[model samples]
Target: MAKNKDVRVTVILECTSCVRNGVNKESTGISRYISQKNRHNTSSRLELKKFCPYCYKHTVHGEIKK
Candidate 1:
């Protein structure tokens, strides 16, 4: 059987701008995205530019602990 650990793991990406500002103009919550990354490939935290509906713009999204 496969072990608990896997090569690819699920991760949550949160908007940094919204987190720092602590407010969302369009909505009442911060924007978040679900994504997956290879654990072996990315040893460090992942950051990506994604569209935030609450902010209504593209912002830097960083990986957060589950």
Candidate 2:
């Protein structure tokens, strides 16, 4: 496991296209890919999620700057 303290929010992807429009940005074609890609250095981990749009939900992803 990793420390959540270093974990901070980085982005919020609008997941309307996945469930509602049936689109895929990446991953298993999940609702959203919220990320810490903008973070300094870490790992890409999924932190939070919500029901996809249509289901009106989204997913949170974390990115480690490398």
TM of each candidate vs. truth: 0.89, 0.25
Clashes of 2: 7
Off by over 4 Å in 2: 1-9, 14-42, 56-66
Candidate 2 residue-wise lDDT at 46:
34
Report clashes for each candidate as comma-separated counts. Answer: 0, 7
Supply the global lDDT for candidate 1: 0.94
User: Candidate 1, which segments miss by more than 4 Å at Cα?
Assistant: none
Clashing pairs in 1: none
Model 2: which residue pairs collide?
34-61, 36-63, 51-57, 52-56, 52-57, 53-56, 53-57
